[model samples]
Target: MSNPTVSRIELWHFGAPLPEPFWPSWIPGYPMTENRCTMIRIVDSDGVEGWSAGPELIRERRGLGDVVGLMLGQDATDIDLAQQRLREVGYFGWKNWWIEPAFWDMAGHRAGQPVWRLLGATEGGEVEAYASFGEVRSGSQRIADAEARYEEGFRTVKIRVHEDEDADIRQVTEVAAAVGDKLRIGVDANQAWRVSAFADAPQWDLDRAKRFADVCADIGIAWLEEPLPMDAYDDQAALNEYSRIPISGAELHTGGEPELRMMIERGCYSIYQPDAIFTGGIDQTRRIIAYCKEKGVTYTPHTWTNGVGFAVNLQLYTLSDRDKPLEFPLEQPSWIPECRDAMITEPFIARDGKVQIPEGPGLGVTVSQEALAQYGEQFFVADA
Candidate 1:
């Protein structure tokens, strides 16, 4: 039988209405009213299909289907060639490794295995969940949210810290007090990749970062993330050696595996987080995992994009060390599970602070046509 070749590619611009405006902790006061992404679907000659999604501000990729289709129309089983072609396209046009995972989704389907098993996960079970609150709120509001998550069975939670050092200290103190010693707490500085779309963001130098790291140590934070800029390798390495708490970051780095490997060699962080969708796709992500294991560093994917993004990272997280809980983006009234997973057949929900790994072949997900009709607008479609 001939190897499966891609027959068609479809791209959709989908947006789900948010219950309330959401301000990302990183980008301080920008109120986001809807969750939007450019969804990618690839169908092979054998009729097997795979899907993935990438973040989008508007329908910017409406003209990309022709370029993407011409480049990715080769054999779907040849991941190496597909990656090479995608990278080549990047040299001239857009380099979206985000779309690369859809090919792996097809490969997994053809083999009748989940991506984790193909990536070498031996034991099969659910991964631990951590409530990752996206916005910076008041001490009382933060405490209430943490308490609600604790009641919801999440044993670990992460909160964001903006500019004011006093406010940051107060927020952590109140939440820690209410949740007690029962929950593990992590803090995200969001200094890794700063966005000033709405309001001016805080800029932290090494001295300020060290000061905050020292305060986090005093306040008993389990881990401190993105205290410095993402590219601050030397300072990050020094801080990792100096700080009492574990330092984590590098989720949105565009440097891919080479830079991550350098960070490992330089002892930049105690924990390494690289989103498979945002960074360099599955191959680079798998390489990063192997390097972390070899160098005795912790590895967990950053899953904050959308439901399809979360599912792609979840598959990779299942093969990780699981020393730290997987990040679950949850904020009430806005970034809830329903809105996050608006395109999928079923929204993923946690039970007792854990999520059952989808056992179906491939990424274990299917797009709901009803949801597509409601939220998706087909912007691009091409047949090979």
Candidate 2:
């Protein structure tokens, strides 16, 4: 059969209001009121539709017409050409790597297979998950939350820390004591991609990371994530060597394969977490996963964006041989499964702390037209 040609493209500014205000630890004092993203839909000549999304703080992609023009007549299954087109767009302005997944989604649908199977997975099944908390709360409240997660069948949980040295150490110590050995705990410093746009965020130096690592080691913490800046290659390598526990980061690196390869060669982190949407889409991320296997580095992806972002990464995660649990972004009252996956026909809710891999064609989740009518605003549409 001939390759499917792109026949139409559409873009929408999608936003789902949160039930309550959510103060993300990465941004310090900013109150996030909605889950916002730019959604894209690509329809081929055969009428098979593929979808993808990118996180957005505002409607900054109103000028995406030029990018859409480049994809108008190209073969939707020719991902190499798709990557080249996206890279060409990056040369002039924003890194639009997030949009590349739509090609994979399109190809998977045409082949009548899941994205993971298209990427070479033998079978489709469920994968373990760790409850990833987004905010820093009092130690007492965190302990209660941890216990609740444990009850829900999550064997592991990741907490946030953004205070002074003493307070940070105390927070982990208290939670570790509360859970004992029943739960494995991980701590995210959120320093790799720090956001100071709305308020002052804490910055971590080598000394501070070392001190925190020492406490985490004593408390048997599973891993410490993004303890230093994303570009601090030399410091990250040094800290990884110094720390008794495993060090992990690299989400939203935006440098693609070459930069990630350099870090792997430098022994930057024991574990490498690259979200496919933010890194360089599925193809580049697959290369990163193979490189991690060759270098003996752990490869688990970051899945904190919206439902589409999570689906994109979940497909990539199945290609890895590593057994690390996928990051399941869950925070109560605000970033729940329903709101995060408002557009998806079936929300990816974790049962017993494990999410069943979607078995449908393409990215495996169906986009809800009704929900789109409710939450998405169509901003651009074009036909070849």
Candidate 3:
């Protein structure tokens, strides 16, 4: 058996222009873009590599130099320690959440199994994907595009309602009028975490969120995600109570354990979508899933960051037996896996609009280092 040692921790940034700009219909004030993924890599003692990534804003970690060394030579096999180290570094404004998948990779390698198998998940099950649009567009355009999306294997879709109260009303009205019964729609407030780097991203007020919730309910929408900021526990709880459909939040909360514990107590989400990367790490995500299961809240890990980020969280998503659908962020030309995951070989092929559980070893993801060499810009590489 391999004694799983942490020989190297590497971070790579690889981005490609999107085929076209995609401004989500919901993020009212954001601009569309073609910029794509920035990846993460981790190699264990045995020379095995595992990869993950975040989108668009690449090279954010050019200065990870002063930090990654803390993980050098540690037992990658000891996931608890790795998770702790990652969480501890987060206190100083640097988020090492993307590195959490490294521990799962090491854990799987040491145990001679795929991470999913080790987590007790069954392979080859199809997970339904919702068409999560990234471009901001009008209600008529949304109706036409969503109609096209239905033919493209998506039974459900998520659109951004970017602070246009009346426009939001029109969009929902069109959706219910056009295909509300045929397709289930979920609106993403995306207010859980704001991306202010871009100048046009619209911010949502609490009143707008509540009003939107009323519209969502009136339209027979399936669920509403992140209507308020992720930490606004009281507001989230209150909205969840009155919202006709399910209420959900918690994507970029790096405070992790404590924040999730508080949300669980306050019943902040009917469905808690914690991104494994943005959270503490794999073990901490495992804890979140356990809590959700115990509390009867649906457990669907968020996967919108990038391809590898999707792959890492998919393993965690399979661990829960909620029998609920998972979020497989696929919206045509702009955010499909082909472009969102262009660097990877088998970029999660969704069949008839659903993805199957992976059976391969590690996180069931393999990155072509040669491809990384071609497109990836190595920002941080630590080996001892």
- TM-score of each candidate? 0.97, 0.98, 0.92
- The sequence of per-residue lDDT tens digits that candidate 2 reaches over residues 191-229 is 998888887888999999999999899999999999999
Off by over 4 Å in 1: 92-94
Local distance difference test values of all predictions, in order: 0.87, 0.90, 0.74
Compute the lDDT for candidate 2. Answer: 0.90
Task: Supply the global lDDT for candidate 3.
Answer: 0.74
How displaced is residue 4 in candidate 3, in Å? 3.3
lDDT of 1 by residue, 140-228 (tens): 99888888999999999999998677888788888777774888899999998888777899878788888888887887789999999
lDDT of 3 by residue, 1-384 (tens): 756567876766676566777665444445456444556566777776666665545456677656767877777667777777776777787677777776676567556677878877765566777777766567787788788878878788877666457876787778777888778888777778766554555566667778888888887888888888766788888888877789887888887767797898898879888888887767788888888888878888888776677778888888777366677776666777877766767788767778877777778777766667767777777787
lDDT of 1: 0.87
Which scores better on TM-score, 2 or 3?
2
**Superposition error at 311 for model 2 (Å):** 0.7
Error of 1 at 204 (Å): 0.9
Q: List residue ranges in candidate 3 displaced over 4 A.
A: 24-38, 56-58
Candidate 3's TM-score reads: 0.92
Clashing pairs in 1: none
Badly placed stretches (over 4 Å) of model 2 are none
Of models 1 and 2, which has the larger lDDT? 2
